[model samples]
Target chain A: MASIDIEAEIRAEPPARAPVQRVTLLAALSWFAAAAILLLWQDLTFQPLVRELALIWGAVGVALVALGLAGSRLGRVGRWTALRAPWLLAIGIGMAVWTVLTAKTGLLPQPFFPTPQALLEVFIYDWPKILHSASFSVWLLAKGFFFGALAGFAIGVGMGWSRAVSYWATPLLRYIGPLPATAWLPLAFFIFPTSGSASVFLIAFSTAFPVAVLTWSGIASVNRDYYEIARTLGASPLFLITRVAIPAALPHVFVGLFMGLSTSFAVLVVAEMLGVEAGLGWYLQWAQGWAAYANMYAALFVMAAMCSGLITLLFRIRDRVLVWQKGVVRW
Target chain B: MVASALKTVPQAAGTEINIQTVSHHFDLEGAPLPVLDDITFDIEPGSFVALLGPSGCGKSTLLRLIAGLDHPAQGQIQVAGEKVADPDPSRILVFQDPTLFPWRNVRANVALGLEAQGTLKSEGHRVDEAIRLVGLTGFDKAYPHQLSGGMAQRVALARALVNRPNVLLLDEPLGKLDSLTRMTMQTELVRLWQQSGLTAVLVTHDVEEALYLAQRVIVFGPRPARIVADLQVDLPYPRHRGDPRLAELRHQALGHLGLDSSW
Candidate 1:
């Protein structure tokens, strides 16, 4: 009977794993339709990007068809691609629709609203100029952010840790924190030696307020038990502040940094628009002056991507540092 | 296995604690609210004791006073003949919540007391020894959130034990664990106390917990906590839970806490 039971257990089949899917059939069909439309029809006006866009859509459709046929051998990328099938299909259809409306037919005006190729033309021809402006913007933002974050962190820690510091800083923060950084444009320009210096001060000013406010709250609201625990373990005042208070309040400090980044971005653009020599905002103004709206649109895309990429990076760093908090605490 | 890295402990026996007319109160909205009402007690060296009381009776507050985390409004607490003016690493307090720094892993958490005192450079091996003693040798890299409640509590014990404290102040250390874990830990606690020779003061509300582990059970009444009875258990180490004497002592303790003996 025991030998029979062993044989029966051995004969039982294992639980089936989920099947590996590539792309949805509809997604492959959507991209193929888009590619066919672009390759077959002649646009009313010649758009250089039309051929490039058609090739991209065609390649995606081919890859999806190949992946579906190959199954799991393609690995992780294939799995990821399968998850984004609906999004890929929607984007393909939207792109085809945009090409029809703008290039194939003169539905939108020319000077104000250009074809897809016109926007791509700025990157193709004027990349060097665009790169220079973006670099200048990055430099100014980096300098301002570094200084602002440092000063704000110090002041916030000071205020949170000491009652005397809180007493003096509270009134000033209440009075000045809410004023927009751009409001000081005229005065800052007059007071500072150069337009560059003035813009740097303005960006720093905007970044400082949010960072300081949120950091102060974070430190102040730290659980009292953390301090007590450290103190009971013979922690000095310095050790308590550095080890217990700061680490305990780190999640909130990250929140402050996030808010500071966005505010600094706004101030950077405004400061650049007002008087700075070269930046994305200056490029936008320069393009508008020549009525080159396509350049403006291209610069806007760069700005949105830059800001979004930084936000995503910050979140990734936070997840790594605060991994232990996944179960213990939630914001 | 490491051969007791804590062999450098200068004071092998536990320190004596004497609380003299200690009272404390909190200021609640411009009114004085009394919490501990003239509590007095003396604990012998290298003995296990429990301050058993109801939740709102301020037993934990008295523990805080003894640890010097807070000052008593009226009286003084002396440990080893010196008045406790501030918290010292030698008299470590382990809270009910494991309270392990969530940012730190087990090894780092156990090294905290030594790190804070700038002695971790020479005494770092004590961290591993404590971990091994707590039966968590392979979990040195696990964070507090990754551990179960009992495991986390064991980590807390290791963190305190690494300091080689003369007096261990336990504020309901096993209160949050499941019943099975609690019983097992009671045995573990007795074994640890016998091995280290450290004076242990545990504050708990469970009657059986007070009787099973502690040599002396100081029972307290409701809010504005006052000692109702101080019953001594003259039992040897490795006690049996089914022993009839524990049941009889349990009845006495329950009677002191205003519960009927029949129950």
Candidate 2:
């Protein structure tokens, strides 16, 4: 009797989300069409991953149809599904086009644009090597970024607070801050004991400049009234800097961090390709040397995913810290 | 249950403020822009006095000096018996804007003075007490952006009141509020002042507001402000806005401000 009542309640709930939206169906149809094209029509012997990809697409299409039939059971996720339906359809259509152009015909030629299966094959066969290089790059990046951001924050705060520091630092920052980290690569490699250290220096230099510039700007632009309020409230100089200045300027610091991360990524790739023996960047160059374009594409994929993942993580931290600044800005 | 550690402090609740022929100027593109011109007055301890003036007349600057956030270029200003050279927790100034820190919630904002003084650990309950005193009992977790203007201003008052300042210097604290909210806040201000027994010095241009709230209204002239008149409001506490004596005092203050209506 209880089970029957639960089923009745489930069935009785009205659709609060869009009622099995047509866009979801369109998305499903597009994905299925991509799968069908991959399965039914091919100009070459398909790799295992290619067939697997088709199966995944077909499964995804079926899942979307089921989700749409489930109405508002998932609430926010259901609404998101409706909104993202266009993206889903576009991705499916894009995949179908990629398949038709690459393995299916010589319309776009070969080697330059590796077939979808060829790219996936590199992922399957070269998983261990790819993982090793990626982890190494991340470890190097983490070290450089952590120290660079710390140094930048301290420098920025000092420059903002004291006239003597600002006067001394401003000229130095102007001279040293804007030079490309890659420009220092050859010199840095010669100066440092190891390639690892050289790459770290390159990444660190790239990360620190933007972070320092933005952090200094942030601290300098803090409202004067904030200082007055804190002063009258018995705040010491230390209190003024830590409690008043830092918290007020954090939003700007986060913005600096975002710019720093991107610049560091660029420097990391350049440094690894030129100096370091192993990393995704080095792997990319190695694959190209051998004319293994599929392997190169695979390394590129890993790099993109890593870069975007780190950025998303930064955004998450910013969201948590700046909860008070609701509706101010979102990256 | 935690005991009130704040009670252990020996600072008195109200102290006298003395302004002695204070003159000050600002550098506007290499030229001297006089704001306060030989301003001289004294505020009685534990009473609300308003410095009534026209816009840009330097009454706000005078309040800033009394709070020790700024110094007089020429003459001296004293509090209790000592010269006020730097800002101290004993005299908290509420600015025209609430100036509540955007990063802090109401509780933390009110607790700022205690935190800065290294007393928050023992005297944290005073923060809650101060928030409640200003009628913001449940908004302790609300950020400054989450609050309305009047509520933010109340948080500012709580932030000041939490410090247990002997002298509360208000530089047009209620000037930004809507008329309806302003009316309610004026009543609350009187109640807060009367209950706390703090020396309250408010700076405002509103003739009626000055007449309504202050025990004495010191009217000032235009820029490089000089005292034109110091009219005493001999009205009782909780004075009505529509009181005839308030209207009479308003006329006198307006006359000094050079806005006396011929009709």
Candidate 3:
């Protein structure tokens, strides 16, 4: 072989391939293949499960396209040129058109779940009722969260701030905290005239106790040096407790609040199942008694979505308040 | 005569204070072990002195006694014409550790001494002036975590200075620092002492450090420690460690402590 012109060859050669691009390409291709396979096999799977899962993937694909095309001039394209967005929009339009056409002409023999007119009735005439039900459930959850978080924070602060309380009350709390709030049904029904008040009280009580205990434990676990330095710096006992101790123990307190909130929600639903005539749990119970399985399932979907949203909001608040404690891993 | 003169001189200075033969012991679980014995010392007005000894030689105990942080069992500790039995801001003690509050930043730490004494209103200048004197300007907002060890200790020094005490007790303040940082701190300490003109009692183990910084360095022996030597530096302010006289004195003092084998 002819001797290579080293300098010229080196100068003419392309840059060495980066592993990052290769890995990213592999990941993107794998994800696209999985989505395509899932979407194509939608008809062969359990119809309800397939529909729910397809909706989730379709939402994801739509979201990607929407976000990608939002700031760009891609929207001006006549549907074909814009790869991500066009594909998503075409799929949605095609599905809507097919559903309408298939109903107008009885072409595909038998349909799954709801016929076109039934789905239309649920979407149009029954929409107002569904909205009312969802809103009522959300309102109940909001009330439970507010009362639960407040009581929990106070109890936590009290227990955490004082050693005597934490020492004496912990054993009692450990026993009480684990016992489900539903166990108090007989007593609650006896004391309160209506199940509504009893439900609210039971949920709040269950949430507050654990929140308070966890907050107190967190405060107690803070480093002794923090307190000693405060003393040496001439901070009065009161000032030390309020300014230094509380702020330092805030992270743990919030965690306790979040935990309490989730627990309260769970207890609220259980309480509704036993007692109340309102709220999402009450609605689910009513639907189940009427043998309306779809309504019961729909109510469940609403509960899941609402709880996820509320929990996300709580975490956001936790992150904002405890930003300084970022990089410090918590147990 | 010197003892009699030391006694009478306090009266002449118009301060009716006396530190009679003092001794202290540590009692651990009802077992008493003596640490210092018959430690008789009288401080005159506006005097800068250093208590020099090796580690575990009870130099810190002597400072703590002066600050009223510790009580002497067999003797008396008098400060500014009065006896001391409890901790007070009047006779401030700066321990070896910076001990700055981790929560409070530099400004708050400096203001602490005045706040504790309830003299904040009358002595607002003290806090600002002390912070400025310590060369920690523009670091008011920095927390202890943000500060280097030297800076944190400087804030501690400022806190003590803000109290405007009759006596300043330093218990090996520079002992924790590395050699370079320690040398820098020693210079800063001298500047502070000269400007403040308050009576200071430094407890240090370094012979040269004590000699260079203090007018008098009181050396102590091992366990149940007592003053073994009271060597006077007699050198002028802003002393040079490289000076032949300082080197010779340091060498001789080192000999007394079995430190300079060449001697």
Best-fitting candidate, scored by TM-score:
2
How many residue pairs clash (N, CA or C atoms closer than 3 angstroms) in each of the candidate models, in the order given? Answer: 0, 0, 2
User: What is each candidate's DockQ, to 2 decimals?
Assistant: 0.65, 0.76, 0.22
Write the residue-wise lDDT of candidate 2 on B16-62 in tens digits: 98889899999999999999999888888887899989889898999
Q: What overall lDDT goes with each candidate model?
A: 0.84, 0.86, 0.67
Clashing pairs in 1: none
Categorize the docking of model 3: incorrect
The residue-by-residue lDDT of candidate 2 on A1-331, one tens digit each, is 5335334434544544435556667778888998998888855644457778789889998988876666456777766666677788789899889989887875777878888778778888999999999999999899889878888888888998899999999999999999898999989999999999998888888888878888899999999999999999999999999998899889989998999999999989988899899999999999989999989989989999999999999999999998888855554
Residue range B2-35, candidate 1, lDDT tens digits: 1143332333578999999999999999998899
User: Candidate 2's error at B243, in angstroms?
Assistant: 2.1
Candidate 3 lDDT for residue B57:
75
Candidate 2 residue spans exceeding 4 A from truth: A1-21, A42-54, A68-77, A329-331, B1-11, B261-263
Expressed as tens digits, the lDDT of each residue in A1-331 for candidate 1 is: 5335323322332214433343345567788887887778787877777778678788988877776554444456555555566677687788678767777777877768777768877898998999889889989988888788787788888888999999999899889988998999889999999999998888888878878887789889888887888888889999988988888878888888899889999989988998897999999999999999889999998988888987898899899988878877775
Clashing pairs in 2: none
CAPRI-style quality class for the chain A–B interface of candidate 1: medium
lDDT of 3 by residue, A1-331 (tens): 1113223222332323211222222223333443454446323223233344445545555454444433223333312222233344445444444443443333453342333333433434445665676676667666766787687776666677767866776787788877887788779978988777777778777777767777777778777645544444455777667766777788778877778778877887887777776767877788768765556556676778888888899889878776545444452
